[model samples]
Target: MKIAILVEGATERAFKKKLCEFLQSHLGQKMPRLHFITQDGPIPKERKLKKLVETLLDNNGYHAVIALTDVYTGKPDFKDANDAKEKMRIWVDNNPNFYPHTASHDFEAWLLPYWTTIQKLAKHNLSAPSGSGSPETVNHQKPPSYWIKEIFRTGKRGKDYNKVIDGMAILKNNDLMIAINACPELKAFVYRIISLCEEDKIIS
Candidate 1:
């Protein structure tokens, strides 16, 4: 099946390379046949993304189109995220067969498959010593525990209230994933997407 992939921002082409690697190794496909569309930056205020997707759907010989947008949970980025989701919903309403997925945060598509693992790795990063004086080392950790607790807000049932739980579930269901600024551990996310596609015969 022909699939169309689109991203909201410009990222190092490494992501596409990784995606291609995934397809070749697992799906027996090449990059030339992949339909890729990328925006220069965050989506526009007027939501031009709708037109872009519509054009791709109208012209491309794709069997399915996956729209991927990064999460902007705050201020301007938040607005962009909400707008993008709304546009996709509208598009889906108009075209029932099209599939669109949005990530709760940037790089979530990459981080999702190994949710439990990523959570542990993030915790380890948080536990590491800050000033080891290694130029190659940069801190990459989840927000403080207090912050997580606050977001989840322990009610009758422990921290299971984490809002991110829903976001992760959404990622797990996607047939295709597009991640921007994904760290190394995120390869599992791509693998998971590939695995699901193969299982459901979405890719041959």
Candidate 2:
């Protein structure tokens, strides 16, 4: 089956290759073809979002369309993961073929789990983000993106964090499962995709 996933800009589109490889580890030969469509930012809201989903679903060639958005999008788009999903569900009229997923706060939270790798790549000794210590728990007051950018800015070598470049380099050698296990929103995101592919649901 062919699936269309609406994602948050260049970083996610670039990360699609790693996602498919991770899914293939479980779904194997049954992995569905995934197309990551970048929105250049967060996915649209309300009627615009509904129209986007409907248009993708309207194509018989696609079995489903999933939307992936971040909770803390710099502007108050969603209160949290559940709020985002519920609102999207309402906007899409609870269509079975349309699924919505979120990166709590933002995608950079996933990268936080690999802080050891980040430190090496950044050439900085800056400690991991302070909080409850859980990546997802890194609240929106500052958010993961803020921490990431801060590290890159002050680090001896990092200088800057390109969402598409440094983000990938940080996660490139790491397993997606690490982030999924550490972040509830990430788990739900992977769960939706794997379950739709008829693969084992990740329980962590």
* Highest TM-score model number: 2
Candidate 1 structure quality by residue, lDDT tens digits, 49-106:
5565566668866655666655542344444435656666675464653545544445
CA lDDT of every candidate:
0.44, 0.84
RMSD from true fold, candidate 1:
12.8
> Can you list the residue pairs that collide in candidate 2?
none
Candidate 1 lDDT (Cα, 0 to 1):
0.44
Per-structure clash totals for the candidates? 0, 0
Q: Write the per-residue lDDT of candidate 2 for residues 1-204, one digit (tens) a residue.
A: 789999988777667778888888888887899988889877998899888888888854688999989888889878888899999999989989999888878888888999988888888889888862579889989889888888888989946888888887988899888888888887877888888878555543
Q: Estimate each model's TM-score.
A: 0.47, 0.94
Candidate 2 yields a Cα-based lDDT of 0.84
| All models, RMSD in angstroms | 12.8, 1.7
